[model samples]
Target: MTSIVSLPIVIPLATAAGMLLVRRNILLQRVIGVVGSAALLAAAIKLLYVCYTEGIQVLQLGTWPAPFGISLVCDVFSGIMLVLAGIMSLTTSLYAVADIERRRTAFGFYSLLHILMMGICGAFLTGDLFNLYVWFEVMLIASFVLIALGGEKPQMEGAIKYVALNLIASMILVAAVGLVYGLTGSLNMADVAVHLRDVRQEGVVLGIAILFMAAFGIKAAVFPVFFWLPASYHTPPAAISAVFAGLLTKVGVYALIRTFTLIFTENPQLTHAALVVIAAATMLSGVLGAAVQMDFRRVLSFHIISQIGYMVLGLALFTPLAIAGAVFYILHHIIVKANLFFVSGVVHRLRGTYDLKKLGGLYATHVWLGVLFMIPAMSLAGIPPLSGFWAKLAIIRSGLEIEAYWVVGVALFVGLLTLYSMTKIWAEAFWKEPASPGPIGYASTSGLGWMVVPIVLLAAITVAIGLGAEPAFEVATKAGQELVNPQIYIDAVLGGRQ
Candidate 1:
């Protein structure tokens, strides 16, 4: 199983290289991208099964020992993330087949996308901080180009905001890495955790943690640092936006969870408390931003930030159940959010605009689209018996268990506001009558099949998750247990080398 651990990373890297060689052939590029993504998904599912059945799997590069050479580790958490990445990657590739213009396709869009997947998978699997930073840089380069691929004015403007803020985040992250190496004399996460236990410079350590929090926080788009997400996320093609929605920010959140739980556990009173506050603020701000948005994509973009708060709430509570909730929320949010963006893309194709005021009567005319949109939309809003309901319930229940009343109250309030935003989109974009029909040349379903297929599959996944919440929750619980007590991860990465 350890031999299979690197397949997720390798497949994308190899696939992207292959696509680059055939960049002129859009058909071949699409074929390579989709097949590679399918392979990655298969590898991810295998890894998840291995982690569950066998225990944590680790592969030390060049057979080097921990704290010395690179290590790729897959625990339940990483396995779960890899699975989500695979889903998003495959779906995005499918959507891009029909949605992306030939000009963009010829411009190495598929190559860059696979490169992005490599980075995301690397981030998930790496067992060290320096490599994590390297992966972040990899993602940043790919995403910047992906966002600005068309060279449109809006894309350029949005790309600038996204890249500028993220660059600051990158610099801060590398600086934090430097400090961690300087203090602990190690870059391996497991090794660093062990070293930090012996260090006595509490103040310096706390400062480093804060720096990490800021760096990953910006990457995660938490609280005041999240404006970049809303400004830029809606500017990309729907396929690109869907992939970003599903995986990018989640990487940042994953970093936070890994560091806070594994390496920075000593200062929970201050660090975790600060996290709780940030989570609440992030939740409120995001929903409020969504409440007034006029564009369909923009509204979803803002809600991404809002939903992020719930995931963080799971981390901030720092309990086993909370961690479980966070894991569950991550699982639910990625599929539902990605599908919403996919739905918006279909809407845009049909109506020639993302403006909510311009779209209407979709529910009456395109009844399947309406049902597809509502499945994810209602799930996002935490409607009962759906994925979001159970995800939010676990997080809220966790908060209530610890009497974190203030953040809990904020969470419930944010859910209500989230529903309002979803309702607003439904009323404006689906229920009301449009003044004009879609533009010519888009009435046929010739190209839409590839795009809608992913939406249908993702929506089905959402429904399945809702109906079979027990087994999914069990997976989340085991993942949460691993996170809460990270000794298993540490031992796997260290390989008894300590």
Candidate 2:
């Protein structure tokens, strides 16, 4: 069980090292990336199954006991996150085979990608506040270079903004971790939770809580902190954007969920209330931003911010059902969001520009492509019988259960606005006539199988989740139960020592 807990991070770490060793052979690097990511996906699934059937699994490094050694913990929630990370890693690696340019490949793209995955997995799996901070830095370094990989003018501009904000977030994260250790004498999250109960500094506790929130909030791209995401995500290659869209911000959200539930459960009236406001504002602001964007990926990027609101709202509501909703939303959005980006890349392959005004008539010529776009686009809009619908339904319904009518209303309105944005993309990019043919002529099917295959697989998963919402929701609901009662996690990590 402990070995399974570590495999998600180990597989990627090893793959990245292998890729580096064979830097000159792009073919070998691609093979290692794809095979390694697939193994990661398998391990993630096995980890989830073990957690669900057995209970939370915890690994203390070097045989050291709790509060004295590093811990890797996997509860149902983290296991679900690990599975989503695996799916995205595998698909993105596949997509990049055909999508990333030769120059980027030769420049260690596969190595960087695996490193990013390793960081993300470590963040999800770590049970220490300081370890989480370390993973954040790892992700930051890798993603900074990834966004700036092409060295294009826009990529550089976006990378600068991305790194600048993240570095500040990183500083705050470290400070918050230091505060936790100072107050609790433990960097272990479970130990911190146990020790915090003995601390009498109410003012300092809440202050530290807010500091942590601000730090993770920036990385999660909520509310006013989200400007960097739209500016950066669109500038990268589609494969990079797909992985970033699926995993990076969610790592921040994962930290938020873990910290608040396990370490900062005190004063929910104040802490969770702040989250509610941030969630509503994030949703409204993101959709509004997306509504006006003419660029394909930019619109989708803003929608990512909006969709994050739904996930956060789940955490804010702070109930079992609500947490389940959040878990479900995070899983659903990862697949749907990445697929949407994949579709955008395919569109770019056919049409030279992301500008909506200049792009047109994909439906007439590439009927399958239009259908592919609609599945995720409609899912993003929360249409019924799709994955997004169940995800949004859970969140909205959870809000209603708690009578959070105002935020619930905001959520419903955001859904309507989301629908409008999807229609805008559909009308401009698919339904409307192309002002002219593709500048370089349309790509043949033979040239697109690598990219298209990943999109198809993700789309199929979205549909599966939608159609299988009950079982899917069951998984989320169980995970939510674990979160709503953090003792399950604490007990797993500490094994009664605390």
Candidate 3:
């Protein structure tokens, strides 16, 4: 079980090293990237299965025990996150084969991508606050390089903004961790949770909690802090944007969920109330931002912020069903969002511009492509009998259960705006006739198999999850139960010592 827990991070790190060693051979590097990511995906599924059947799995490094050693903990929440990472990594690696240019490939793109995956996995698995900080730095470095790989003016600009905010986020995280250690005399998350119960410095504790929230909030891109995302995400290549859209901010959300649930519950009235406000503001602002954007990728980028609001809204509600809604939202959003971005890339390939004014007739020419785009797009908009519908329904239902009527109203209004945005994309990109139409000349389909397959697979998964909501919701509900009761996690890390 421990071996399974370790494999998610280890395989990617090892594969990245292999990719570097064979840097001269671009073909070999691509092979390793795809094969290695697939292997990691398999391992992630296995880890999820083990956790589902055997409970939380923990690996203490070097045979050391408990608070004395580094711990990799896998509960249902982490397990589901790992599986999502695997799916994204595998699909993105496949997409990059056709989507990333050869110059970028030769410049170690595969290595950096795998490194980013390793960091994501480590961040999800680590049971120590300090280690999570380390993983954040690792992810920061890898993503910085990947985003800046092309050295285009916009890529560099975006990378600068991305790194600048993230570096501040890192510093804040370190300070928060330092505060936690000083107060609790521990860096282990479970240990900190136990020790915090005995700590009497309520003022300092809540202060530290706020600092942590600010730090992760920047990473999560909620509300006022989200300017960095829309400013930068659209500047990158579609493959990079897809991965960033799917995983990066969600990592911050995962951190917020973990820490708030496990260690920062000293003042729920103050803490959770703050989250509720942030979530509502984030949703309204993001959807409204997307509503006005004319650029294809830019609109989708802002929508990411809006969708993130839904995920965090579940957390703010702080009930089991609400958290389950959050868990389900994470699963649904990562797939639907990434698929939409990939579909954007496909559109870019056909039309050569992300500007809505320059693009159209996709549905008329390649009807299958339009159908593919609609699956995830409609799912994202919360259309019924689709994955996003179930996710949005779960959160809205939980809100009703708790009588959070105002937030529920805000959520429904956001959904309507989301539908408008999706319709705009559909009208401009797919339904409207191309102003200047012919072949819509671009790359040949021969090279696009790698690109198209992943989009289709993800879209199918979206529909399957919607149609098969029972098991998926069960998994999310169970994961939510684990989060609502953090003892399942703390006990796993401490080996019953707590």
Model 1 RMSD vs true structure: 1.2
What lDDT tens digits, residue by residue, belong to model 3 across residues 1-498?
477789999999999999999999989999999999999999999999898889999999888897998999999899999999999999999999999989999999999999999999999999999999999999999999998988999999998999999999999999999989989889999999989988988999999999999999999999889999999988888999999999999999999999999998778899999999999999999999999999999999999999999999999999999999999999999999999999999888877788887788888888998999999999999998999999999999999998989999999999999999999999998899788875344645556788999999999999999999999999999899999898778888887686
Better of 2 and 3 by lDDT: 3
**lDDT of each model, Cα atoms only?**
0.93, 0.92, 0.93
Runs with alpha carbons beyond 4 Å of true place in candidate 1: 437-445
Summed over model 1, clashes come to: 0
Taking the tens digit of each residue's C-alpha lDDT, what string does model 2 give over 1-498?
Answer: 477788988999999998999999999999999999999999999999999999899888888888899999999999999999899989999999988978999999999999999999999999999999999899889999899997999999999999999999999989989988889889999989988988999999999999999999999999989999999999998999989998899998999999999889988999999999999999999999999999999999999999999999999999888999999999999999999999999988877678898889889888999999999999999998999999998898989999999999999999999999999999999999888876444444445889999989999999999998999999999999999898888888888788
- For candidate 1, the 10 contiguous residues with the lowest summed lDDT are 437-446
How well is each residue in 1-498 modelled by candidate 1, as lDDT tens digits?
377988989999999999989978989999999999999999999999999888899998878888799999999999999999999999999999999989999999999999999999999999989999999999999999999999989999999999999999999999999999999999999999999999999999999999999999999999989999999999988999999988899999999999999999999999999999999999999999998899999999999999999998899999999999999999999999999999999988887788898788888778999999999999999998899999999999999999999899999999999999999999998998776766433544559999999999999999999999999999999999999887888887886678
Model 2: lDDT equals 0.92
Q: List the residue pairs that clash in candidate 3.
A: none
RMSD in order of candidates: 1.2, 1.1, 1.1
TM-score of structure candidate 3: 0.98
TM-score of each model, paired residue for residue: 0.98, 0.99, 0.98
Q: How far does residue 215 in candidate 2 sit from its true spot (Å)?
A: 0.5
lDDT of 1: 0.93
